[model samples]
Each structure stands twice: as structure tokens, then as C-alpha cells.
Target chain A: MSRPRVIARLDIKGPNLIKGVHLEGVRVVGDPNEYALQYYEEGADELLYIDAVASLYGRNNLTEVVHHTTKNIFIPLTVGGGIRSVKDVELLLKSGADKVAINTAAVQNESIISEVSRAFGNQCTVIQIDAKKKNDKTWEVYVDGGREKTGIDVLEWAQTACELGAGEILLTSIDQEGTRRGMDIELIDAVAKMVNIPVIASGGVGKIKHIKEAFINASADAVAVADLLHFKRAKLSEIHPYLISEGIQTRKVLGK
Target chain B: MTLNAKTISILDYGIGNLLSVQRALDAVGASWTMVKTPEEVKLSDKLILPGVGAFMHCANTLEAAGLNEAIIEHANSGKALLGICVGMQLLFDYGLEQGRCDGLGLISGYIDKIPDQQDDGSARKIPHIGWSELFLDEECPLFHNFSHIPAAYFVHSYMVIPEHSNHVIARCNYEGADITCGVQKENIFGLQFHPEKSAQAGLEILSNFDSRI
Candidate 1:
């Protein structure tokens, strides 16, 4: 059986990593690279670097961060935010990014997904979907840094992204994002059921139990926790065993 | 045919990070250099193809740089050659990515989209990224210092399925098909994962490649 992957997400706005109450009142969490190496040493399987200001700034800071991070760490890094074209993907990869995530650009120009995929290969392109539950019945998709509402159902966007050669789906819940209430398991389960590719469950993780819940109920191949890890509330050394006890397959703990 | 005293040439296609790959060679203390010219590739004992991009673009860029024929010549000279990710796909005969395009044809195979396994309405996702275990088929030099089920980082959607299964050196099960993660022949090797970014297992794989040459 394949082992479940544990990923730590770091949301960067300028030089600081912000922690908030549901993506609102953000507090700086110190240098992004400093936090990255912390999780890396804690045995976090992968690191996600999302430039929160990319859409607002009209550019991605991945090239600068990735170049800086890859110099100190050896783990794979996936970057997202404001990736508008294949050239953007090219620059990120050249700068040592293992994978590039596309959200707004892929939704606006679906062909860009295939175009970038064809130019770089599908493995390098990741489609990040930020969904907010509008009500009990429908969820709206947000693009351009969650500033614009597409009104399109998040499910439809996810299916289309996979068809366009998006290798992985970074499914995030805007309503649950940064809440630490728990992962929006419903959204994760829904997306995981639809996409055959590896689905990474993101948003609404408050504790180690939330990670376990995300994996077990959502059946996600991996889960990304931002607040819990960023705040040093949960360490991977303890998380893996907890996951194993909960019937999740994990890579053999290296030291033990 | 012996590469007893030769330098390994790493092809710098200007698409992917070559420094980490170069550093891996340096970590094992292997005599290697990044070769941008055809002359460098021809004289090397081994060739390392490292790249990140669409198959056609890489093929085109390589041809444009006058390294395509040089690659063929290197292989024809019986020099060991290895390709990573898109670099690995370039060793095949053809690729179906971004329309039809020709490859180096060093090995017999083609690159195709990862077939969708969801019958219920999921689109087949491209760019499979993450770490996966290698189910080694035969004991090759690449596994010398690595554990049996060493984890390596991967980031690709399309993969090489050679006509002959004998050429498959390692595999990782994704969806249902045993995706061809690694391929090898007498003097050629290709991996769909980035060994440079794959951590210790990755470094070990590079170390084994160095020892083999």
C-alpha cells in the first residue's frame, strides 16, 4: 500500500508568514524560510510555498523564495500564486522549484493549463482551487487571490483542471481556510472522489487529530496543515504514529 | 567500452536546475561537468540529461542547441547516458504530449498522458508530484547505497512505457498502471523523478550512478 504523505503549507505575504482567524486578522509568524526549515527537520513530507500577495502584486515571489530555500533544504517544494503562463512556470522551475501551482490563470484560460503542461510536463503543474461555501447547497470558486467570484461550482473547476493536465489538485476551502476549526472534510471527500490524481487536502486544520481526520475521512493522498505546524503546536514525530494508529499508512519513521 | 577513466557530462538544457544535480555528482566526488556544447558530450564517458519542461520544447531546445545529434553520437559511442524527468522522456522514440513530436529514439518507447482511472467523471490530472517508492526490478548500480524501498521525489504526468518490459528498471504504482518510473538498458538510464530533489535516497541513487560509470 502507498504511504500517506504529510505536507506543511506556508502562506507568504511579503516577507512574513501570516496566521489569522479565518484569513482575516493576520499576524506575522517570522521569516518564511526559517519556518520552512523547521517543518522540514520535523519530517514534514513536502513544503508548499504560496505567495499570498502574488495575485495582488501581479507576480510570484516563488523564484526568490525557492532559490533561497532549495539552497538550504533538499526536500521537494511546490509553489503557487500568480502563475499566469508557461514562461512563469519555466522561470520557477529554473529557479529550483519542484512543482508550480496554477489557480487563477488556469481558471481564466483553461488552455494555459494544457499549454504549460505540454511545455513543462504535467508533473510540474499543480492546480490550486480556493473554494468558499456560499451556503449549504453550493460552493463558489474564487480566483485572483479570492478577490473575484467566478460563480462556477468548485467541483466543475476541479474536474476541468484535471482534464487540462493538472498533475495534482491543491484543494483549499476558503470558508475553512486558517480557521483551525478542522479540515473541511466534506470538500476534501468530494474532490478526492472526483479526481483520480493525488488530492492534497488544505485549509481548516487546527490540530494533529484534524490531520488524521483529513486523511481517514477525506481519503486524501496527502494533507497540508498551515496553522498547526506554523505555530509549532504539532510536530511530525508524534503525528506519524498517531496516523498509523488511525489506520493511515505513512513512510517508516527514519530514526525509529 | 569500459569507462574506466572518463568524465560524466551533464547536459544543461536551460530548462531545469543543473546545479543540484551537479552538486550530487560532486557530493559523491564524481568527476563531472555541465556540458552545454556537443564537443563536451562526445568526449565524456557518461552523459546526464537533466531537464524540466514539456517534451517537445525540450526536444526542440536540445536540437536548436545542436545537442540532439550530439546525444545520439554519445550513445552510439557506447557512453552511459541518463535522463531525468522530461530528460528521461527524451530518450524515447516519440511523445504524444502537445501533439506528436519526435524524441531521441535512443530507447524504444513513447510518452503518453496518464490515463484517467475515475469512471465517475474526474478528469485525468497531469503532473503527478510527490515522493514514491521504487519497486526495483533488477539490482542495478543505482541502488548500491539506497534502501530497497527508497523514496524519491517525482513531478511528472506523462511517463515512458517501453515496448520491452526488460528495459524497465523500476516502477511505481499510480492509479492502476505500473507507471514506468525508471528505465535502463546496457548503457542508458532514465528516471521520471528528480533525484536531486529526492533527498538522501536521491543522493544515493546519484552516487550509485557515479560508481557504475
Candidate 2:
């Protein structure tokens, strides 16, 4: 098993960092770069910045944020939101992002995954699935930041994306997002089991226990925390030690 | 072409993430420039080859751009030459990614797909995307201060098997298998890990390379 990573995820709308419930009704949190740099200093394993409304606006605006963060932050950075094609992936990767997350474009075309994988190595392509549970055993893929549905089963889509050369899956539970209740353990577990690629469980992680649940219960390679870090409900300093104390292996964040 | 005064030259054939390498070199306080043409390659004393995308495609792009000759020549001249990721893979004689393809052959090795199954016959994650602990096995001065035996950031679906064990400077364990993470033959070195992105440990590696070489 790979070492579990605790990622500080920042969702952006326009120029401001924001958070919302069930992928809607977002409120401004703070500057994306400021929060990102803080997490970097606090020993976050990695940093993820998603342009909150890029899908609706037909553009991504985190290029500068990525540039600014990588200036001093010395960790892997994954940038998502509205990244649709290999060219879009190229832009972010050039701007200092180590990986690019695609959802709307890949779901709409399907072939974009293979194209990006071939162009920039599968390691550079990430499939971001905004999933909402359709039933006890099924989750549907949503696009444009949960504003639209594709009727695609989340498990099937994840497997297909993996076959099409996606390096990792950013599986977010629309239902549990920003709820501070917990992660959609069932959804993440199902997708993680269906594919051999790493699955990063995103959305709805409140307490330190939920983070452990994502690793032990869901087998998530990484857990993305937005609400907890954004609202100061938790800190990565607390999260990393808790995991190790529970017998889970994580890289020692060499921070003060 | 004049071998200008830039301390390091990152060979840019338009395939990999050159900006991050640029940033890392900057953070380590190295004077560097992007070399795109064979003539520019001739002007570089210390060369860093960074690669991404399919192995065959990257090999073809570098060959098509005619930068390989000057790079090989630079290596032959006893100057410091470093390859990162696919750039490191290209130093091998052959790469079996899409098909049998030729490489710079600075070192004797082959680049091939990482086995779908782990050594224990369990399912292994392709691309190996994460930070893995690296074990230093050699005492080459290039790693003199790149020390601390830090964990590194890695992202690739291919493996490089150097023909000689003496060339391997470091190794890392993955799924009960010992994979070569670093190779060095004199001034020519290849690193499977992305030192440019490995946090402080990475910066330390880059800093060591700059100061030591």
C-alpha cells in the first residue's frame, strides 16, 4: 500500500477561495494562494487547487495561483477545474502543476483521456469524478461542478478512465461535500476497488476520524480536505500524527 | 555556438515540464537557461535532460529536433549531464514502451513498461504516482549533500533496468520489488525520481548537484 497523503484542497470561484455544500451555494473563504501557502508551511502532504467555476465559465484561473504557490512551496501540486483537453493540461503543467485533473471534457468526449495520456504520460492525467449517489450501490457522474449529470455510473466511469490512461481518480461525493459530517465512504470504497489506480477521496471530511476512515474504510490513497482546513476545524499537523498513531503510514511532514 | 556562462542548461525539446525544473534550479540558486537547439546544446557545459509523455514519442521528438548529438557530445566531453524521469530513461540503449526504439545509449540499459503485477503477484498501481522512500546505496559525491536519504516524488509507468549495478546510485522498494531509482556513470547521471519537485529534500538534491558539479 502507498503512503496515505493528506492534501489541503482549495476550491476557487473567480479570484476568491470558496466552499459550498453539496457543490452549491458557495461562500468566500479567503485568498487561495494565502491559504495554500499556509498549508504548505503547516506541512500538508500536497496541495490541490480547483477553479470553482471554470466549467461554467469555459476557463480556468488558477494558473497564476499555481505559479505563485510553487514559488516557495516545495511539494507536488495538482490543479483541476475546467481542464478539458491536452492543451489545457499543458497550460497547467507549464504553469508548475505536477498533475492536471479533467472531468467535464473527459466525460463529454471520453477519448480525451487517452489523448492526454499519450501526449503527457498517464501520470500527468487525473480523472476528477464529481459523484452523487444515485442509489445504495450506484453513483452518477456530474459535470460543470455538479450543475449537470451524465447518467454515467461512477464505478464504470472510473474503470473506463483508468483503462483510458488516467493516472489517478479524484472521487468527490457531491452529497457529502462541505457537510462536515463525513466522506462518502461507500462511494470511495466502490470506486477504489473497481480500479487499480490511486483514488483520492474528496469532500465532506470534518473530524480527524473521518480522515482515518477514508484510508482504512475506503482505501483511498489520499484524502482531500477543504471545509476542515478552510474553516479551521482541523489542522494537518494534527491529522498526520493521528494517522501514524492509528498505525497508518504517512510521510513525516518535516515542519516546525 | 558559444558555451556561454549559464551554470546549467536544461535541454528543452518541448516534451516535459521545463518550468518546474527552471524553478527548482532558481530555488537552488543556479544560473540556468533553456537549450532548444543542437547549437544551444553545444553551448551547455552542464546539461539536464527532462522528459515526459510516451517514451517512443519523446525519443522521436528529441531525435527529430537534432539535440541528441550535441547532448551526447557534451557527455563525452566529461561535463556534468543529468536526466530526470523520461529524460533519464532516454539515456538507455533501447526503450520498449510502444515499440523497440533507440535512445542516446550513454548508459547500457533498456526502458520498458512497469509490470502490471507486483512482485508478490498482487495488483500494482501503474504510474507509481506518489512520494516513495529512497534508499541510497552509493557514496557518489553528487549526492554528497543531496543527503538525508529523503523520500522522493515519482510519477511514471515505465522502469529502467541498467545493465550494470555499479551505475545505480539509489534504489527504492515498491511492492516487494527493488527498483533502480538512480544511476550514475561518472558525470552522466539519471534519476527516476523528480528531485525538482520533492519538497525540501528535492531542493537539497538540486542544490547539491549545482554546488558539487
Task: Pick the lDDT winner.
Answer: 2
Question: Each candidate's lDDT (Cα)?
Answer: 0.79, 0.86
Candidate 2, residues A1-256, lDDT tens digits: the string is 3478889998988788999999899999988888987897777878888888899988888788888778777788999998877788888888889888998999889999999888888887889999998889899999999989998999999999999999999999999998999999999999988999989999899888999999998889999999998889888878888899998887766656
Q: Looking at every candidate separately, what fraction of the true A–B Cα contacts under 8 Å does it contain?
A: 0.37, 0.54
- Give per-residue lDDT, candidate 2, residue A3: 71
Taking the candidates in order, what DockQ does each have?
0.38, 0.60
The TM-score between candidate 2 and the true structure equals 0.96
| Candidate 2 lDDT by residue in tens digits, B1-213 | 566554788888887878888888898898888889988888788899998877899999999998888989999999999999999999999999989999999999898777779766788877687778888854776667554537888888888999999999988876665788899998998899898878777888788788887
What DockQ would you assign to candidate 2? Answer: 0.60
Error of 1 at A79 (Å): 1.3
Give the winner by TM-score: 2
Give the range where candidate 1 chain A is weakest over 10 consecutive residues by summed lDDT.
A247-256
Listed for every candidate in order, the interface RMSD values in angstroms are 3.2, 1.7
TM-score of chain B alone in model 2: 0.95
In model 1, the runs with Cα more than 4 Å from the true position are A1-3, A106-111, A147-150, B1-7, B23-32, B98-101, B109-113, B118-127, B147-149
